[model samples]
Target chain A: MNADAVPLLEARGMTMRFGGVTAVNNVDFVLGEVELRCLIGPNGAGKSTFFKMLTGQLTPTAGTVRFRGEDITGAYPHQVARRGVGIKTQVPNVFDGLTVRENVFVAAARLHQARTARRIADETIEHVGLTRIAGRMVGQLAHGQRQWVEIAAVLAQEPDLLLLDEPAAGMNKEEVARTSELIREINKTKALIVVEHDMQFIRMIAKTVTVFNQGSILIEDDVHTVLSNQSVRDVYLGRQAA
Target chain B: MAGAIASGWASFAAMLLAGLVLMFGLPHVFDLFGLLQMTVFVAMAVLALSQGFIWGYGGIMSFGQSAFFGLGGYTYAVAVMNLGDSTGAVALAIALPAAFAALLGYFMFYGRISDAYVGVVTLTVTVILFNVFNSTAGDWYTIGNAPLGGFNGMPSVPPLNIPGHPDEPLDPGQLWYAAMGSLILVYVLLRGVLASRFGRVVVAIRENETRAMLLGYDPRLYKLLTFTLGGGIAGLAGCLFTNWGSFISPTAFSLAQSAQIIIFVLVGGLGTLLGPILGAVAIQYMVTLIGAQQKVDGNLIVGVVLIGFVLLVPQGVVPVVRNVLQRLFVRTPRGGTAPVASEARP
Candidate 1:
């Protein structure tokens, strides 16, 4: 990706204040088209808060978030999604009572007509390796499978940018490996920002990583550089160790 | 999905046929009074359907549905007296309540009122309307020639007339057909709406609002539309009620009447289209029978039945019956195993 090309997503001086505490402070980030970036940090390090602001889940108290070169500050989640930005929150958000296929179908239906949505849902389900369990209720699925279902639902939207929060959090090792592969495959066509604490999983998928600490970006570098940075280790890896 | 929709349409057709048979064929066995009583049940079923669509499917538990019902009745009564025409009055009856609902719903939904507060606000609105209507007994409390009638309630409400001729009011037999026809029409229409893309989105919102929003749907807009549609249906039911009893009353806005509507949806199967109708007709018939016997208070029996249904079959009659039927008959294609039973959860 050319550095001179217009980035797919750009956040400038973004800050979020909850009363007296500043959850995210003055974060500037950029992702190029077809880029795969991993955001890693300790709990309450403000990575999640920054992701929320980027995805329109939370409006920054100060600063701007631009998508495709247009300001989308304080946009509602629905509005953001409609702009071809797919978001999967930290928790798996799938309709429990609805079938896996129906879950994807509803998401696809948001962008396409009903007839087209059906085809998209099936194709997305198959892409997510959930074809066999398409007819099964989402609630009955295992935790990892439910997470994939949520991913499939987001893919059904055919978004240009995918923002996934802790997509591999509860997954077993095999599931995590599969998820890393899935994210890499998707990154071929769409830009992605995966927020995860698992270094191994991030190493498998991310070429570049952004480290967040104290509500601000502490470092942005290649995976090797970020892993070797002493400050990154002290604030994030040190906290994880404790 | 197509198969599910086809089965839904098939059930709708079956219900329509059954309704026609009961409406036209039953008169031969029952007397005029019996037919008249059946008309009232049909009207009540319409009211229950409105509640079912809003509360059961839309996941909006409203306790002010009676406000719309009473609004419809009063609109029809006042309009009929002024225009001397039932056709235009009927239109106004449905439109007035729908418009009011749209305005009220816009504020409540857009204001982001919480679910619990929604119930309280709606219930309070019904109570306020009931008290207001109850106090309008003065000579000045009149719309056109129709007096408010205060606690005594408005009497001699003009019956629905033949479309063009105001002098020719519908006879009892015609009124029965009109009520039954309206019920069938509303049922078919509601079923079709529920099968549409919009209906799927609405149901998805009911299931998981945040997920629906993340899918690019504005939940507030869908909620407002559903609330307004439900209000219109309730208004239609109120029009039918006025025609059946030839009266309008502040009792239409009473909390008891609103609670009874909720019971009808609960006993029938909340999300199922036909469940609420069945619940309403069955309960109304039982009430009429018990009232005729004069041994126990009809309301007391209804209260007991409501409690029994809530405790024994919380999912409602239709869903429980459907589950049993599915378990007994439905089998998976891969194996001869019985299909999993999934209850509707909002």
Candidate 2:
């Protein structure tokens, strides 16, 4: 058996519904250790719903989520987090009134001792290229900076599988490139499940892509293969089929 | 090291200086009766601090600190009347309220009660206690050789004696020193707690529970512990309140008491310990002044002040004043983000 023989994460028969609307329909997904996988989909395509299920934000209408070999179905977000699963939500969920260093410090403090957390906070802030503005209040930072601060906080968690939702949601071209580089550097050691909408940004970092459509995964393959598929263009790229 | 001494440490040092000045200086400035009255003000300031700690820092919308205060007063009165000693009674006072708070907090936090509902529910619980205590007037409602005199209250409640020595009751001057000492101790204790890792995490939960939960901290447990501590502090103040007049009454749990605690925090400033102390003493002094003159009703004036503060200075006095002073004194580059101390050291 290989060192990465067991999947790092596994979700089986994941489903979600709101009233009569089936937001996500029985989707199964898996990822290996030390791998980065991108999830791409159009708006309302249920990728967000699936991501929420994976992160324990939503208790699926029907499904089981497992980390390594443990059953973590319908676990609370905090419980999932303690099991070495960390997530960066679409919005920058941070302590807005606190300094950037403090925000990272709190996250780092969760899994480490005081001195260690402090060292990690400073390191993470530097890692995310926010060292210059580390003392500034997070609310006072620009949108892109807040996102990076959130990413730094997530990194401080030292999670086995880091799931990021729309990490480049509002970034400019320069910021997007920087984020992709950050993601690549991070992916060298950790596994990642990134839900993204930006295909151009995806090309910079994604080796394997999982394109989702109509509440299920349309295709899971190498990024180049998925990008060239004709049906993927029609469904996700919104191009007219020949 | 100077950078490590952030706003939190600066405020703590200022409070220590202020406490020392008040401890030595106030007795000389006031008559015997004035010293006794000042003791009452000190006790009430402690009450205000309790509410301030919970509602401001805990982010718990508790409108029932008066319930804990009243319970403390009544518990101290009953236990002291029976045992003829205040030591066990005083301990009971703090423990009872903390226990009650843990029970209430368990239900509220565990039940996942909404914040708005928490405020409403706590207010309703206080009102219920007021009614229940108001009706326990008959001789039949006695507890272990102590009377629960209902609305009339157990009058002439025994004053607190030196711990374990029932005969050695504190005289007016000594009581004033004791009460003032307690206030200062609580202030310092809370400041020390805030500077600790646990306190920082509590503030983090107050900032954003969802974020805190995501970071592997249980917000409910934190909220419960904070609410319990607030209850215990209010109870301690209640014991002092009972000793002030040598009386304990249902009126301690009155709606007026509930509102006044909020008013104190609102007037002085929320999220700061000194603000409540200042707010309580100043407001109580103003009320006494208004009481001395029959020209205007004190309640009406206080009510008007509450409305005025809410509309005019929503951030309250201390914060607004601190911000103004910071701007005037601290020189930062114009239009640049104001530099803040990076992280507070414990």
Tens digit per residue, CA lDDT, model 1, A8-127: 898999999999999998989998998899999889989778877876778899999889899999999889989989888888888887778778989999878989999999899889
Query: What is candidate 2's lDDT per residue for A71-142, written digit by digit as tens?
Result: 988888889899988888888788887778878888998978868988999899888998888777787789
Q: Write the per-residue lDDT of candidate 1 for residues B1-346, one digit (tens) a residue.
A: 5544555556667888898898789779778998898899999999999999988878898998999999998889888988998999999999999998899899899999999888998899899999999999989999878888998878888899999899999988899989999898888777777767788788888888988988889999999999999999999999999888889999999999999999899999988877889999998898778978977888999999989988999989998898888769766453122221112444
Candidate 2, after superposition: displacement of residue B64 in Å?
0.9
The collision pairs in model 1 are none
Candidate 2 residue A187 C-alpha distance from true site, Å: 0.9
lDDT of 1: 0.87
Number of clashes found in candidate 2: 0
Docking class of 2: acceptable
